[model samples]
Target: MSLAAQDAAKIPEEIEWTWEVRPAHADAKLPNVLLLGDSITRNYFPEVTQDLTGVANVYLMASSTCVGDPRIEHQIAEFATMEGVRFQVVHFNNGMHGWGYSEAQYKAAFPAFMRTVRALTLESSTLIWASTTPVRIDKEVGPTNARVDERNKIALALITSAKISLDDQHALMMEHRDLYKDDIHFNDAGSKIQGDQAAAQIRAALSMNRLPKAQAR
Candidate 1:
């Protein structure tokens, strides 16, 4: 079996889950955008959809699955094909979960993450890599920003080398620790801040410096 399969077989996480959202009655006239990340992404998703209202149909594929598990790649494929929509922009991230996997294992599996996302994008599809947010609580059992930072460094090197734009959410959140509603997730207000920034980035990517909002589908 492949290394990722081995890790999955030995998976240590107490629970595994995935959440997906595609705009209902999507506007074919507008371009599709996808936000792929974790629960943190989910928290900010509504605000992003609202911010980009009438501008784009925002879709979300947030999961507890981390980079080391091979399922992450398969799940991404499933989400893409299941929607059958060509995303104009995909803002993707991982590195918050799967603490059971070592950084070395993460590094080893990083290429699959890159390749999987790339395969799903079109020639015109814009890709943005968002750095994972910091872990605020000093938990003996969960994630640490130190590890998050290290993983960011690992991803940054590869992503920049691939010439993908970065959303830099890690740096953004570092300035707003006061917004943390929990150890890892942000409050609604804080999540709105993140969503606004994401909308702004996607706007810039779409070259919509000034665009009218359309009623959401």
Candidate 2:
């Protein structure tokens, strides 16, 4: 098996949990965020939450499933049922799921994915769509990083016309190529960098600047 597949199989089937920055935080009401993405975002959530302290209430869920699966819909539905968790930012990534799908499949499901996202929250919640990060195709990663790039463009187009803000994670990954441990995944340091970038994007979209040190927890 490829390294990606091997690594994926080792991940527990149940939702892998992480240390959440508690809601008792001083800035708890700033905004609530839900991170939805594949392994890359999954691996990077800790770093994301760290930089986001005092800026938002962040919850993360990682799935290795592709964008075409029914599980994507199911996952969103489960999150929607979280009582009293008011989400102000729903940051998500999914082109990795679209990577190997046929052209027809991607075209059909892309809109459905957006609809699902829109249906998940209040009409005013800011939606940030991350472009698929670059991969080194020559390595044992997935098929082609180029495919990821293509799908990112599709995602950008969809979000732009829909008027949702887009976080260019592809650009972030390229800016720090050394962060990646392999073609498609980041080591801990890289993951932290990615998380920091994501925090910045969400901050910008919501106009929530980083708070003073004395005020942050």
Candidate 3:
């Protein structure tokens, strides 16, 4: 009935993930945006919402499982229908989990998941696919850097073919390995930087999609 109750009902009992909705200011008239990913997204989400203040309503849907996980599609569908709001942009990533799944298996499931995401959002909504951030070799216990790279390559090919915008978070973090606190998570400063990048990309995508009709003519 309530938003929380609805979220609870949507989440699978066996799934392990965190779902948080950051409502826009009640009086603030702005576009809605959704950010989907794992803990890396959780780390930077606050900064993203803050950075986009007065610009858009930012929502976050994060999971501990891989993007290929079937349960994630259910969570995403719920997020899209929350309060009957349609997001203007959906920025998403998921490659940190699913270590048990081989690269080929990951590749096979990715397109289907993207299809679900596309179906749930507005036809005009900008779908941005963020590559998984790099993991520190010394600290990562599940996915190694080599594995991350392999998965990312597959993701890139699929995302490009789907005609989705690529955010390339992997490249953003590659040069700042020191900013990472562990294999996959970033420190506060790192998160801030990531949030800034994500905000900029979302803003750009929104602007591009909202171009003046007269200007086009």
The per-prediction tally of clashing pairs is 1, 2, 0
Off by over 4 Å in 1: 1-12, 208-217
Q: RMSD, each candidate, Å?
A: 5.0, 8.0, 6.8
Give the Cα lDDT of each candidate: 0.86, 0.68, 0.79
- Among the numbered candidates, top lDDT falls to 1
lDDT of 2 by residue, 153-178 (tens): 77778789888777788888888887
Top TM-score model:
1
Clashing pairs in 3: none
Positional deviation of 213 in candidate 3, in angstroms? Answer: 5.1
Instruction: Name the lDDT value of residue 63 in candidate 2.
Output: 65
- Candidates in descending lDDT order: 1, 3, 2
TM-score of model number 2: 0.77
Clashing pairs in 2: 66-97, 67-97
Task: Rank the candidate models, highest TM-score first.
Answer: 1, 3, 2
Which candidate, 1 or 3, would have the higher lDDT against the true structure? 1
